[model samples]
Target: MSELLKTLLVDQLNVEVYQNRKVLGQVAAKSVALKMKEILKDKDRVRMIFAAAPSQNEFLEALTKEEGIDWSKVTAFHMDEYIGLQASAPQRFSHYLKERLFDIVNPGEVYLIDCENTIGDECRRYANLLTQEPIDIVCFGIGENGHIAFNDPPVADFQDPAIIKSVELDLVCQQQQVNDGCFTDIESVPTHALTLTIPTLISASYLFCMVPGTTKRDAVQKTLCGPISTKCPATILRRHENCTLYTDIDSCGAVEER
Candidate 1:
């Protein structure tokens, strides 16, 4: 078990800081696996939303290796996808999740966000799929600018009426993609993406947020210490009754210093 470096309650957000990214991922994965088992015990299936980014690499890798949970009873959905990226674009969130997770665990239903059709049609279709049943869990990470999914500060809506929608990418968000090596440069990154809104994401019964690395230190600090507003979009996690924020030494550095 990874040693817990610190624990804090930022409003309702349960924050846990670990020694390092690897240990943060392992401990978060183990806890999420246990939640999967508990939910599957009384339910026919488990539905989960996932975020795809290099920040999620450790958690997804660790989760897939966990034993005992019946993956066949789990349905998966990714939180966001680039709207104009080529089908072959390596930066596509769907492809990222496929390579790191879906292909590894082979969930019973893997619903990826596709842009082959009109973005509107795709958004409606995905929203329908998501609302057909309740979401058991949401496993995700924050951006360098504190966006959750693709709900950047400029576009995030806490009470958004749409379950999903296309949003223009914030410049900081685009640069973070470059920083994470998902894009060669900011100019090469997609300008828009399809993302589930804050309401849809927080509707899940359980939320396990894994944020690691030095790049996210500022965002993590804002999420935990800043006002609860879309200005730091991810600060809304504080209002989610069952959400847990998992961080590593590097990501939580700002909090430690303060």
Candidate 2:
């Protein structure tokens, strides 16, 4: 077993775990489709958290192709957006999500972060919106720093009081965004962003984390093996009752699961 898996085992942790390198992208895509269908089966009004990143392209494509979802009944809330970015900007998470998923499904409602507005007020407004209804599922990705939902390494608080906040981007996290093609280079990437706090995500009924590529291997290992600390923000998922991590072969590396 890999050190990451060993650590998880030694800690006597509890979480529904599934790791795959074989047919990684396909498995993740299929799993997401099934989960969406499962959630929509009984609930007429469903709310979800949408994540935008290159790693999620395949998964989102698979979701868009899946039939039978009552798109009109679903509502979506964006997980994060770049601070100072206009909704029209190509780098905006809102634009990315709309082109990839929302435009295809035409959900009942789509709440995007207004990054251009006063950052603090926007966070509070978004928080109030999240409180209006329970989220059925949240789609997310792991940052190269093992962060989740833009909640960078040093700022991620499992018990954060604010539902959303403006955060300064760490070097690793910013570079990862650039490397993923969200920007031409590190200098072009935004220095700050608005992100959903760890507590807000933990409140969700379910969370699906999709992380692929070898570049993320170390992060995956750290998040899976490291202590449940803000340093490894994504580790908080271990406390979630219905959280899932989906990764491709290169990303899984030495982690063992049969």
| TM-score of each model, in listed order | 0.97, 0.89
Q: Which candidate's TM-score is highest?
A: 1
Candidate 1's displacement at residue 48, Å, is 0.3
Q: Give one digit per residue, the lDDT tens place, for model 2 in 69-125.
A: 778988889888898766678989999999999998899999989987898789888
For model 2 the TM-score comes to 0.89
The per-residue C-alpha lDDT of model 2 at residue 152 equals 90
- Write down the lDDT of every candidate, Cα atoms only: 0.92, 0.78
RMSD of 2: 4.1
> How does candidate 2 score on lDDT?
0.78
Q: Residue 179 in model 1: shift from native, Å?
A: 0.2
Instruction: Compute the lDDT of residue 179 as modeled in candidate 1.
Output: 92
Candidate 1 lDDT, 1-258, residue by residue in tens: 667989988889999999999999999999999999999999999999999988888898999999998999999999999887789988788888999998988999999989887988998999999999999999999998899999999999999999999999989999998999878889999898899999999999999999999989999999999999999999999998999999998999848422
Clashes of each: 0, 1
